[model samples]
Target: MALNTIIINTTTTTTTNNNNNKEDKELNSITHFFCAMKQQSPRRRRAALTTFFNTMPYTIDESQVLVMSSLWSMAMTNPTNPELPFSGALHCMSLLINKSLSQPSWLLLHQNIYIPYYAAHIIGSYTIKSSSLAELAVDAGAVPLLLELLRGRLSWVEQRVAARALGHLASYDSTFHAVALHGEEVINLAMKISTSCLKTVYTEFILSEDRKKYHCDLLTRGLGGKEMEDRKAEEWASQLQCWSLYLLSCFAFKDKGCHYLICRELGFLRELCRMWGGMVNGESPAGVGLMRILCRSSVGREAMAGCPEVVLSLCNLSRSSDDWQYMGIDCLVLLLKDLKTRIKVMNMALDCLVDLVELKNLGTRYNVGSTITKALLMDYHDHDKINSVVYRLWELKVERKRREGMMVEEELVKRWSLGEAKKKEGNERFYSGEIEEALLLYTQALELCPLKRRKERMIMYSNRAQCCLLLQDADKAVSDATRALCLSSPANSHCKSLWRRSQAYDMKGMAKESLMDCIMFVNLLVGENREKKKRKVIKVPYYAARMINKQMNAVGLFAGVVTGEGINMQTIEEEEEEGRRRRRWIKEG
Candidate 1:
């Protein structure tokens, strides 16, 4: 019996909670509907509120009043949260805001003017980075609402909010689809607002200056406003124009959006260019930004080609020494990359490129930029005309680079040839026994030798070493021979340089160093003989024994008596001549 009673009590508690939840939901709905009604005029408000209250089962007592207060607080404090019970109210406010902005009837304006401004700003701020929230705002009729605000007489702040909301909504695919559904009206209204703001800014500028007495009255009369405080207003107007342009850019950012924009009017590029002329670089980015997007597309490129104004504007922009300068060049480069585009467009792109190149050269000749060569080389189509155009531009780039490279190479060759001629002249002077003149010429050749000619440079050093030895400068001979050996290849075996160094070492009384070189020289000579004829057995032993005797005499009992002198070159030459005769005799036998 106690178990049954406990189960019954549990069931009773659950039912009670469910009843309270249902009651709370009805009350929340009533409060939400009432808040939405309050945004209407007094007559509509009274009628809607009374009707809702009369049909309601519960009245607003103290606890219910607290519930209503909390709901309003949440609506105002956290309007961005989609979970709030006031979501219906937010939607209603959004629609009403559009209505008031579009109609401007006194009754509609009287209902709530500032509510839409605040609502639009809050919605725009919340949705700027959140596509989900932007879609939600769009579902609540934010696009048309923002469009209405943009079309009507909105304060700069309201216009800014509305323009930003439109931009945010346009960032989503679904919302942009909805936007494109009304593309003509949206584009036309945005252009109108931008043009008006631009005109107002100009007017404010004209009215800003006071007439100077020195100036002619007829010239300055219509241009001067004595008591106009339009500076602050002008700034706001400019800001609004910038945001309006941003909204337009958002529309042009996508492929479908761009198609929709230019499909209606081929002259749209001209209008955009006209607006671009009035835009300051740092103060506004959207005008030029939209132009960049337009130039990115094939249709837009074609349109831009037909419009000379756009070409001139881009040319001017490319010359500006500002942040947008690269962007201007980038757009032109993009158009130039696709040669498969229309001929007119391609010609226009070429003209723009030539203008940029000229301006770039005028600014700085050496540091120029290039487009991605691979993009131009990509096989987008098989048309010979298109391919030839790309091929021609590529050839121009190649030719330019080749000409520059050839110029550099020619200079290098001239220097190298001079070096070689000096070396030949040095050889002639050396053979003529002009030792000093030969030394100077060899030094000049060494200086002129390029780093790439390693072998030639080594040979030059070896030749200089010979000159140094002939001059009895043993130190200079060792230095030059050592450098030649360092640059020598092992396969070729720098035997001449090694022998010269060995002789220089002996002149300096370095017996151990001289012996090492003599051993290497004998080994190389014997190896060469074994690879060729086999008749070098006798002369090899003789040369080895002579070097060993010199080493022993220099290092042992006769160390003080011996001078470790250089090789007897004349005797060695006689012995080599005799060995050659013997080898010939052996071969004849």
Candidate 2:
């Protein structure tokens, strides 16, 4: 009977919590609807609040309040947490706080808002980290207010946050310049942090950290095996560390204005980035945003030099496990594109893309996954990228085709080539045609082909497929041909392979596909032939390339591209929607 009541009570608690969640959600929806109705207006917002208050009396769940409270408190401390903490009457108040800034709403005249009245800030120990609060704070000129609170050395965490909020205030050039000019004060604040116990309350492992350069890996040491509780804390530590580094980096750049400051910060940033190489805190986006800012800053010389280390570390994060690699890959790609970090970026990205089908995130993986997906598509537009993805796809296609026909082609050719004397010894062994060995040899030969008269990947797959067909692997033959079709038009591939795929399909009872490929490949090839025949070959004499123009004699050879550093480099500025990429490459002769 006791167990039954206990079970019943547990059930009731769950139901109540679910209802509260529903209430929170419904309240959120209604709030947003009214907000949209008001377009963030005062009266509609007030009406919305009136509705929330009207509904508030119907709700009461003290049992799991702390659970919800913990989440709310988390949202307060971490800016990246989703907007649940600001739900209902409280969030509405926060919104009202900011909305009143642009327009002196009557709420300000009244002074006491619902949020502070409820004492949510004191109740939950919430800070202004909640974005709503941050936005409102920024909107309300909280820069000076926050700076003042950061003055004395408080709990190490509080001092760090103060430093960060001050850092954020300088997000824009005007404010950044303002903050930068406040050098003595900022330096004084940093000096306090630099001197304090490096180790503070971060998830557990951070507690054990040296608070120095070689701090323990948050994921490895801190969490140990208790991932659930420790993961969030570890992530927050990474973000805070990154934010701290960013602010300091910028601070050093702005205030001390010396090489030593820049070098130390740059060195620290490289280490911090290394520490953060693979950790994911989907809840915190400042890391990605901070890195982007540094990349875009005038400190490119040092930042770019340190970029590869960042990529290498981030890639290590990726290769650690499949759980975070997807998001890591996305961030990795963006990190890769940052000026000089492409090589590591491309290789890892291509490797991951080839193996994974792209997955979604539940708790904190959404943005990073989307970021990676967009980059993959972006790479799809590049020739080398297309070549890579397509080639891998064709590889699978070839295997499928080979399985369909166990006979011989690319593999068979290799088998035959293996022994010139064997060919003379027995026509029976050759043609009794141990179809399996022949097929293997033919496919192997295709792989070893030095120069393709057509599309390389397709030709290889096609030869392998025919070997399969000879071995009566009909499905294998069709699969290879289909992949070849996708890899190249007839113009780009050898003719025999295309026709062979068509014939292989016909034998496999796929006559329609066979006929379609036959016609399509021929038409494409014909088109290419016509274009080539019409185009003139640029046969400029080698001497003409080296010849000096009389009009440019005073300007010397005038063959090199112009550069700011007096470099005669072949640097091209390719302006992309995201940013500019100026690559200096060897000029084609």
Candidate 3:
């Protein structure tokens, strides 16, 4: 189904230490309120959050909110560029949502704010008042995108946010009927994550009202008279926080929420098996056992004790690659942490590690071994398996690390010996007047040295370049000099190497190539933003370097913006809800 894009007139700003100003400080002050609420319990957190929203600082301005909204939009769409402002906005949402079991309500709030925003973002641009003031997301292609996200638990943050957003859509209508992506393809692709096939509480919500949040800067605050995208983002975020906290409430208090989740969302676990594709055992038609138990449990638990099955299931597909295994592991880890469900998924990780070792893929074994080692070290007080698995994990990790360290040490020793021999050979070749042979020997020696000897390598690279120049190997000469320039640490060494290479390339009738290399030398390594004229015979090309400066600057800015969004968007729901409530009341009045 197509979702309507709601263009809000909200405003916000973030302060990067490097980009600090008066405005940044004030914006941070406003966000600090949310940050403080992060420490509160579910009930107190909500109360504190509500109080904070009610007593919002009067100095808050519209332009600031607009900026923040633009930043968020940029981050979401700027997945490629990375500088887009809202890029790490999900992190903000996670902070608001991923609370302790004690704060289930706040967690629900966190879930709602980001999920709806994600749904809306997928909606694309909208038309309002016959004048498109801003672009709002639509739901034209969100299903496929969300399915893709579920295919691998950790493919893309944007996609993960979108998938989680589906749950919120289901909740928005207060029905919890739609088990999103409960279809065959989505289920089969997702290793651990599941979607329900039959009627669930969210099913009603998904198919219910299709109301568009029509936000305008000039309009009154309400459904149609929604606040500006920039202004109300934080408020809408607050509303989402409320919903997520509510959902989280389903998990705590020793209730049957866990088992009911599996049963109420009928065929969810089955779809998970189906989505696992090649990894599935294909036994018993995907959760025939789960079906009977879930049906029995959901019906029986509420009437009986009410405590749900707190344990979840996990898989370990040893034949799969790191990416594939990571998908499953991430889901398990997340479920364990967020759902307060203890699952016996560590067996899968152990199986994967054991298989990795058995396959004799040293690199992969080392990688998996390292991963389990970290897991073993993590605080395991909550998990029962850690008692049985920790020692084994430690034993394996020690063995792998020992072997790896030995291998590294042996390689270094071998390189050192080889380098010594090569250096001797180079001296002999140089004394014999065989410059080409001498250069080859030097190159061999340089390649054998450790990173600590990078300065020596730079010198050798320079000499090789000189030899190549004499031999009329302009390409080789340029390559050697360019590499040397890159490795050269001292200011004088870089200046000389870059100058030599630039001149040598020009002499070889390769001005364009030389220009490109010279440009890279300055911009990437030397960072030659300015130059002072001197009586030197040669100089690095300043114009070429200048040409790429904007691109690099843009990349740096985008990175900063993305990182900031990650930091600021932790409680996206709280911000959004706070905005929505104020707007709604104004509209009603």
Candidate 4:
């Protein structure tokens, strides 16, 4: 027994030593990579950078201050500029991208483009989670070099990383001034890039299929092919715009001059409304997030009020189940709260605000939507019109309650029982391949269900939506799903209804709407799993991920115009107007 115990202790010691050795080897490799970066030979540096780029993503260590310093020096200092501080040795590499490049020239071009990108990326990654590391990066002169990349020194790919790094650096109070030194130029560059980056990427990389040879090698790193290149291009393009907006957001409302500059750019405001950042990137508030920031300032509120399209966009966003719906509601509330801009925006906002009188889960305060609507109506100069509008909405609400009422407690219980029985029958029929009979039964169940029994009504509507989907009636499916969503407590939380609506929208070829619903569905699933399991990492089901990817590709920004299937902006506006008209209760009141 003594010998066995001794043997076990020895094995444990051996395993611990092996782990320590492996960790030491990794640390040494990082140091060697920095050493290679300092070498005078271009080939050695390029090889080192490629390895660093591929491996750095998997390795994040905040203890490596030496590695951070070397990266900052490489990222900020131009090798070709001998006068620059910390400049590296200059090599005879051509920076131009050529399709018919000799092997050596291609290697040289690769080094020129990738070194700055990889360097900026490493700096951003290290600084992302640690304010101390961000301070270190700022102290090491990372801001100026990152600014050069943001200026499109190499390509949008570099701009993506540069903006991301600078955004991180600016997020810390200690490092913000390092970025603020070039505040005006940085804000301008970020705005310009945010507005134009998508078009630029689409035109340069996606549209010009012939130019694929130039960057394909770098994009795929020789491990992947065209599909990977395209995917990376799309993701990087999105990051470029998103990171640029993120950088601008860090500066927004902090400086009066910067705030005015952002508001004065009218085209940028319009683009912000349209830049939804796609459904795949659900976490990014994208344009709405920036708009929300701008809304805080007087100038931003006035600027948004002056733009009719922006006001309309906000109204549409406020009424939808999009992830940033509350932000949209906040923007409108800000616009309405400001006495100066209230009149300018009241006419366009009135219709949407009236519809939201019953919105319960939007803001932190109870009945927040009612509070905003009441404020708008009370503050308006045209009291007669406002009074009439309020009366009409109130009348509609009273009538709805009256029609669904007139039942005593016992009657209500009986009806609820009947509704449950009908629902169970419908479910049985649905599973037994009798879709039409199931649809009729669900409709009867909805009729029998008390309106006050919101949960039961929601389930019945969702059941009917599924039947509509099977029947190929997309319009009815959408309506029933939307109704079910409206009845759900906290709004848009019914996962089955959201999924059915998404499929119905897809059948109608409304990629944007479908994508939004799909994303909401996936987010709901993720949120539920996290709460129930108490796990840090949330995994989306495979089928849901696949749906999101498909919808993302279908809803690719600028793809319509690039592929000769562009939508007419005017027609889209007319359709939106028509939708508002349908929901308009106080028209010309």
Candidate 5:
């Protein structure tokens, strides 16, 4: 009997006959059709199954679940077979879309775990091939059933299919309520699966999610306990993680989904950090892509500040050569937009920017630009996101130079303030003859100092050198003095650092080194005096005459220099006179 004939009788004879008897007859008819379907050959079955669904009744009465359940069982039993009635079942659901019948179909599919798995298989295989059908299936309430399939300890195959299907559904429309409802769960599952799969294959080290983070600890740490299981298990777990990440990434693309992701319970953001912490794992791209999506929103970016390692993980990935650098920059740019919100975040961003610029200068200064710079130049179309970040970092660097006397940028000033307080305490200790204590304070100041405050850092280093000289550690004094001199700009180079290094060299009996440093120090002071006089004479173009003035100062300073067994270093009185003259010139000018 045709499915419609049985459906007509079941609806019409509801009171004439017992409802159970009518449902049984309708189920038997559906059963007979399925049995006949199994008997047909592969080509016959495909055509017969297609025709059977096309002719089936669209109405889903209360007793319709019995027939739908039977069809779901048949599909599950022959899940891998290409000749099965997969398309028939999907077509039946598609016809039920947006009708009172659709909810019943989904209810039956969700009644048992097996049905959801079956539905996911059909979706993963068929719906993915057709957008209209995928949308149709989702509209017919496939998402809830698919999400149900993801729950619990289902087989890897079932979970993979469910995740893939949901990914397709979510990708089609990110703002789907289904995506937002379970976005956090999906992120957690993806992170859990990704970490598990990574450990199974590599088993190198167990990662710690503690906030007491060490620099590059994620990269260097090792996990060395159990040997990995079979490669097949690893492969299956990897696929599950990958699909789950893809699904979660789809969820992250929308504002509500992104908000749910970062603010979820059990630290979903921390899990993301752990997944992206080490070397580029299999889930890195998906993880980075999700981060990129989250960065598109202020709520998402604000939530990210709670996970401190997120910034560190991004910094680590930015140093890598993979495409993750692109996503990492996207994330960092968003975080840097409002630096006043989180001091720790601002510090981490500054650290990353400095590392990126320094990394680009590793081989040669001018040959290759930094990773962030290259991305900004080559991917300018993405400028609103990428270039703004790179430009802001460069602008900060330039501002750092301009504000040599006074710390600029509120965040930089905040960092410098703490360092300056420590330096002041160190200065007091040094004046009171607490040489060792003063050295300790100076070292602590260096830790608190911002990298952008080059002048302040140089002063701290020079202070430590003075203490080192008092402690009779000539080598340490020389090291500190040289660092201060190198850190200083050409225009504001610290003559005291050069004089201290000269003293250290004299104590070490290196007469030539002492003479050279003393001569350089004297020239630096004398050149400043000459610059003052020249400024009074006429406003000279400094850039045009810079090299010429440097040469002239070199010639004048060396004429008084004599390298011998006895080195005549500049006296303290001479240094005081030079300082007083410079101060007087400043007041006179």
Candidate 6:
């Protein structure tokens, strides 16, 4: 019988009077659907199944035992009828995959490809919401059939739904064992699919100009052309990888042995860290979700700690604004909580963790950023150790800024020009003896400058340091100079900022620090002169040489011994006066 005849028969049997309630009509449709399934005609049964599958709600009630059993039989058993003995959905799926090279006609392709996908989908959907339903599906032998599809007996399209069904089945304690019986094969296949599904889909469907008619129709749902096919291909590809990871996570969460298998394949973990799933499906956790599951095990944490690339990828993800950003942080925290892994991965994670210290509004945990920072740092009793990590973080941040500055986007260029104009005005004000006004202009310019303009921002910071120095704010001067030095391409290589910080440290009576900065400043001056003169001979600037000599004398190893206790007030006053004279002389020259 034709499909239309079957549909007409179903409508005739299920038709209700206008007075009938919606519940009555739905009940009638269910009754007629089962009646159609019992018919000997293959076309009638197939048509009825398609209609029922399409209209079924996501939540299947317990009262629908017969409906669930029928779907499982269709999915798992070869048809007993001699007319179509090989026409069971799973059997046909395998046959179609095996004989796909012969290039079947469009109708055969559509039936074979779509029936298996829908049968697996219905099984998964009904089981996902209730463990009882999942148990029933497991008893009906859904795992082996689903496993066939997952093994790529068909294309990635079928593997997508197969993985989803198996994941749902594996999630329940009652049904997990059935799935775990083939745990090794299941995990290995899931990992393989997750790692290569994207490329597989692209090669089979999206990249093929002469795509099969059924594939194009299925991808676009017969509504569009190549563009729609491409869109659907990417979406399905993402689903394939995500659902595969979801399956692996089920095993990794329940079994420790699974963690060893998963983490042992470090390449897969690295791939997982890069699967952000947002481009195709925003809500899918992709690889980060799996990484979080793996982090829950000691074996997994050690494996991740051993792979630098995977740890680096997590660090990158934690610092991003991606939706799974917290999961990345969670994984890192788990690793850090382990003493053995902490020592190995702490340095790489420090930069990202330090950046997150000020993060806010992270999914209802408003203070999580600061809380995590405090907890991580609590292990370090020595303040110096904490300071050293923070110092290294600053250097990493500055290098990142310098690298980003090389891009020079259009909007940033405009902002940088505005900052330059402000800096020019500040210089004019300072030359005119309007020291306070110059200070304010430089502050505004610093705010206006884009973070990407590292070189320009370095100059702004150095100028602010000078203003702070003359305003008698020694601490602020040191801070600004340090920022300027960090922003320099090679840290501590900015001559002016080094000299200004040296002066600020000298004012604070930090003789050792002051002496170090003065020597660095003198060395930079000599290097610059050698570069300009193109000569082997070195000649430091007169001002730098003088500053270096003063610092050397002030910080002499025997100075305190000779004076019986450091320089006296009059000598300090003379040094300050000479500093002022030296500054004026350099400016005049």
TM-score of every prediction relative to native: 0.44, 0.32, 0.23, 0.63, 0.41, 0.53
Q: CA lDDT of each candidate?
A: 0.57, 0.42, 0.38, 0.71, 0.55, 0.69
User: Which numbered prediction scores highest in lDDT against the true structure?
Assistant: 4
Query: Candidate 3's residue-wise lDDT over 8-96, tens digit each?
Result: 21112233333567657666655645554465565665555444433332233333333334434544454333211122232322222
Please provide, for model 2 over 467-526, each residue's C-alpha lDDT reduced to its tens digit, 9 standing for 90 to 100: 677777765665555445434542214455556665565565433334444544464456
Model 6 C-alpha lDDT versus the unseen true structure: 0.69
lDDT of 4 at 149: 72
lDDT score, candidate 6, position 300 = 79
Output the lDDT of residue 388, model 6.
Answer: 75
Output the TM-score of candidate 6.
Answer: 0.53
Residue 203 of candidate 4: its Cα lDDT? 82
Better of 4 and 5 by lDDT: 4
User: 2 or 4, which is superior by TM-score?
Assistant: 4
Q: In candidate 3, what residue range of length 10 has the lowest lDDT sum?
A: 127-136
Give, for candidate 1, the lowest lDDT window spanning 10 residues: 564-573
Flag regions of model 5 displaced more than 4 Å: 1-47, 52-119, 174-229, 276-284, 341-343, 358-589
lDDT of 4 by residue, 239-319 (tens): 787888888888984655567767655566776787776643557888889889988887778778878979978976765
Model 2 has a clash total of 30
TM-score of 4: 0.63
Off by over 4 Å in 3: 1-119, 122-180, 183-435, 444-452, 461-522, 529-589
- The C-alpha local distance difference test score for the whole of candidate 4 amounts to 0.71
**lDDT of residue 92 for candidate 6:** 33
